[model samples]
Target chain A: MASARLPNLGAGNYFGLGELYAAWKNPEIQEMALHTSLSALGYVDILRVPAPILEEHVFPFMETPTSTTMEIAGTPVADDALMEWAVEERFVNATRVMVIDLDRCVRCDDCVRACASTHGGNPRFRRHGRTFDSMMVANACMHCADPVCMIGCPTGAIHRSVEHGTVIINDITCIGCATCANSCPYNNISMVAIRNPDGATITDPDSGKPIFKATKCDFCDGQPGGPACVRACPHDALKRVHFQELNPAGMAT
Target chain B: MIRRSALPFIVIGIATFAVVAWYARFTWLELGNPSIVTGYTLLVLMLMLGFFNIRKRLSMVPVGRTSLLLAFHVAAGLLAIALFWLHTGTLWPTGSYERILAVLFYLVSLTGILGYIILRSLPRRLTQTGIEVVYERIPAELGEIREKVEALTLECTEKTGSDTVAQHYIGTLNWFFRRPRFGLSHLVGGDAAGHWLRGPGGAARRYLNDVEKEYFDQILELGTLKILVDRHYACQDLMKKWLLVHVPLSMAVILVSIWHLLLVNVYAI
Candidate 1:
């Protein structure tokens, strides 16, 4: 979990310690410290307090519903009621995206190997491609908030699923230009050499040539437990987390 | 104001038709198959246009005209995909070169399409919510502001007898250094620069000078925000990045196109 908070940092025990030390001497940190003086006292207490600590978990209170409705079809329908009834549809616009729980990840290469095996010999998936805070992040599409890959697609071949909010590369529509491969910030998209069964490969229906498409972890939309890699992990290392729910302030406790 | 360089896309319709004609002739002559020729031709053109330099050149004149070119680029590419299918006349084939070319073209087109969506739609929506100041800009701004902030720290140090340089650096970098590249633009968004530059003209009596002045303000603001400095290096990185994708993909498109042509010729013969 701690590693997950800083996935870009890569694997190492003293990850970013040098940078952190530098930050400690920074004026912005000092200013922020001075402003949060009251909160600082509690933070100071944490240093003074013993490491092994116990705390009671309290359920947070939910804010009261402030209801508003858009007139869809000459109806003054309750928005909340309609939304509650259509929970799946509401998930279509979900802002809560997934995160990699790095601590539990063993990096055994099962996910990577499984992805390759499932998708033929193409090595589009990685068990530990990138990292954050001394933890290696297994390479998979992050399904980013603002996906860069979606930008350059001339056709709407790549789109976010309204239901899952997952970035998808529509296979049939995809023209295999490798534009998304270049645009991806995380380098998550993998190009695959697609083949057909019967020990033979196929050609693009249109171009009369082999069909290649960008493939990545689709979170196993119809498969059991979502993703095959996650499900197949022997170490139980993989789990999708809602970043907002997990880390409100982006700090690992 | 839309820059003047996007002129070619204005006549994209004519260019596209001409390219198609050229493609049809070349394909029939070389491949002896219309569909194969069309598919490969479309792929080559799409990949070429996908190049940032080419796109920039096309977008020089009128934004609308450039947009029309972009639309044609997209349409021709799609039609070419159909032509590819028609050229093959089947889903599966028994040739390696034939399949490789087709596959490469497919991937290139698909990725290009995805890129278009991100360029056209995603940026507008995402730019509205939380402006993603380029990472390059963040560091440069930090450095520039770092100089000023460090000087301020030195002044404070002289007075207070405390070496809090580190503290000050962090403080200023986080608070002041990392800022939206275009705060006002993000707030009012897109046409705000145009509005500011165009003044009250609303495109009626606007001159090239007016457009240039608007661009000047934009460039000046970008400089002030240190965006230009960041982008100076960043432009190279961006260009390289796109080149890695666009240029090679274009080459692949052309290669596959030639192969597709020859294969169709042999098949017909």
Candidate 2:
């Protein structure tokens, strides 16, 4: 594996004066020093590393120091070094969630037609919306790595699940403010006009106005077959992408 | 208050509006009328807002705001195509505007797909991390103090001349049990230079210069540690911005798509 570039602080030193001065004044430095003195006297923190060094490097390491070591390219290195090496180059990796095979699309409008049917005539919810010449693609969410929508979600309704890595909007938490819609980079999500299962428009009970909730294709997580559009498409034109399969060598893969 | 970041939104807005107007001309989609004009207006609004969401790097937006906007843009695009199809009532019509718009819409959608792929896969390749520092906690002053203690030990050792058990205890206690024991890692890791060789106090022995050299290296190591922290922060920020370019363009394409969709629906025979 290619080694990650270590931050160079030598002849090519890059930090500005302001940052250096700030570090010179960091309170944590003083605290760390005191802790180091204490640890030297044999008081151990949960980790065996001395307190001061542990505190300063805690954010970077984010892991316990293991005495265990392994050979890497014929070099016997400590476990902590190997773990840091693994995540050195890549930060937050993103996985592809949806794919549209333009080659397979018959333009039968089944996906769009199915989405419209599912959403009750609001064609705004289609898997593929079109342009003057060709078809347009649609889906509620791309589940992006940098979810701009989550930035301004006032009620914290929209969130990227840490476990599955899917961005989900908690309906009960959403206030139907449309902030997510306004901030959406692709406009895939919308403040859809909501209704009861029976097809009548759901309205605010107190305000007596039609209720709107942010809605989108959730890949039909709870459904047995997965995403409604993927399952509903007769042509198999759409599939949730797992980008890892596309680029085996890429970090996410 | 508008910055360079807001430029994409404005450009996307005007371009989408113009496309809608042009599409209206080629198709009988009531180019000069109210509902169609309103729809076109919304397309511009959507495009501008979508672009801003990305360029500003609004951290508070939901995780998939860019993706959502693209999806909505696609839907709006389809409506535009549907309107155009309604006007022409047939596909494969030999009209220049119609053909150009059709191809352009396809291109935009294709680019949008590619942008999504880039956004999803890139950041993982760019995780910025700092070096492994084992003694960043030691303040410059305290580290210097520890250096003095080590220097005293070395000086005292040389003065006493005999490497006795009592001498070793005194040296170890003076070096590790001094006012601050923070620099021991530097001592163990050989990073403390020869500061420990000089023994405690400013009183210089023959090896005092070597102890000073160790103190100097400690100063350099501390600086290197800070530089790593800043670099890590910078790389993370850069990775976030890269997504801005890839994701916002999806919105612009979506805006153009609306006009494309309307024209297709109106003009298709």
Stretches of model 2 off by over 4 angstroms after superposition: A1-97, A113-125, A129-139, A205-207, A243-253, B1-269
What local lDDT score does residue A79 receive in model 2, on the 0 to 100 scale? 22
Once model 1 is optimally superposed onto the true structure by TM-score, how far is the C-alpha of residue B248 displaced, in angstroms? 3.2
The lDDT of each candidate is: 0.46, 0.45
Q: How accurate locally is residue B91 in candidate 2, as Cα lDDT from 0 to 100?
A: 56
* Model 1 CA lDDT for position B150: 48
Model 1 reproduced share of reference interface contacts: 0.00
Q: Give the Å error, residue B53, model 1.
A: 6.7
The per-candidate TM-score of the B chain, in the order shown, comes to 0.47, 0.29
The best candidate in terms of lDDT: 1
Tens digits of lDDT, candidate 1, B1-269: 12122344435545655666677778687856566555655556555455433533332122232333445555556555555555566765568876777677777777666544433332233322222333344565547654654455455446555444335335433343344333334322344433432442223222324434343343233334443333223322332244357557757777666666676669765
Residues forming the 10-long window of minimal summed lDDT in candidate 1 chain A: A1-10
lDDT of 2 by residue, A96-130 (tens): 34444443333334444444544455543444432
* Candidate 1 positional error at B228, Å: 13
Q: After superposition, how far is residue B225 of candidate 1 from its true place, in Å?
A: 8.1
Q: What DockQ, between 0 and 1, does each candidate earn?
A: 0.01, 0.01
